[model samples]
Target: MDPLGALQEPLFTVLETPVSWTEVLGFGSGALCVWLVARQHLANWAVGIANNLLFILLFTDAGLYADAGLQIVFIALACFGWWSWTHGGGPADRLPVRRTARHEWAWLLAAGAAGCAGLTLLLDRATDSTVPQWDALTTVLSLMATYGQCRKLVESWWIWIAADLVYIPLYAYKELYLTSLLYVGFLALCAAGLRSWRRDLVARIAVTA
Candidate 1:
């Protein structure tokens, strides 16, 4: 038997859609990666690298080309995040979490909007993407969130939550039930992360004061 044959074999069926082993694996790793990140664990980046690769395959196979491309970007960001988390805190040993400032939020919002518009036009004209608008919105916002996460900014969770809300419905429409479910799990994890990071920020402020 060809080893690649199993890639298409359904591990189960959900809502008349075949849920493949690849999607299952992607969902599992994604959930674990998000949970670990919520706890501020250094290991999250390594797991996230694996998740990004798996998602790249899954989204590409599903014809979600924009998302597939986003995963490629995610892999690069994950690598940068791994290094930053390990060594980017000066002499503090770990990067401290901080709330995003108003000026930084303004820049991020503007960049996200511009990126979404550009990607939407590109995907609409250049690709056969099914849901270009929602896809582009999530992809650009996710890029911002990942960058914020790398810098240990507490507001990254807010961006992730916004992206996840859009992703859940979009994936469900695409019949990527497992990936949709993963986004649901991600919403819960984002909540946990926001709270955890907020506490960390509070303590840091107390210490500096």
Candidate 2:
């Protein structure tokens, strides 16, 4: 059986749009992963890994090569995040939400700009991608956000919000409506995550003081 065959099976329909089982599954796992992360639960990484795998299949079928490729990097980052959250903590042995330093923000912004430019050029030249700029921007922002998340930075949620806003329209234009809706949900969840993490950061700082 083909690896992508399962992704082709229709789970439902939305306004004449066929929603695949893979997209439904991806939607569930992706929402769960973000929710868990908002609650500061370690299992978000594992759920995120499953979500990444599902999206790899979904995006590949949609001809979204950049997004499909991004899932691979997300998988690797998820693994590192899983381990880091468990061991790369303070004396409490659990990661705590913290503010991103100014210097780190500068580095992250520069890297995001550079990555988006390079990936957009590559996709434009190497693939038949029509929305290369949007794809590359979302992909690069996601990478920076994931890295920030691994460090338990409160700013990660902001980056996620930015990526989700771009992803929603991009997925819809690609005819992946369900995935687009998923990003809509992601946008709301990112706000919740930002609020939750900010609260945690404030509490941690108060304790330190």
lDDT per residue as tens, model 2, 112-160: 8899999999999999988999989989999999999999999899889
Superpose all Cα atoms of candidate 2 onto the true structure and report the RMSD in Å to 1 decimal. Answer: 1.2
Q: Tally clashes: model 1.
A: 0
lDDT of each: 0.90, 0.91
Model 1, position 47: C-alpha lDDT score = 92
lDDT by residue (tens digit), candidate 1, 53-132: 77777888888889999998998998899888888754476888887889999999899889999999999999999899
> What TM-score does each of the candidates earn?
0.95, 0.96
Q: Taking the candidates one at a time, how many backbone clashes does each contain?
A: 0, 0
Off by over 4 Å in 1: 1-5
The local distance difference test score of model 2 is 0.91
Scored against the true structure, residue 7 in model 1 reaches a CA lDDT of: 66
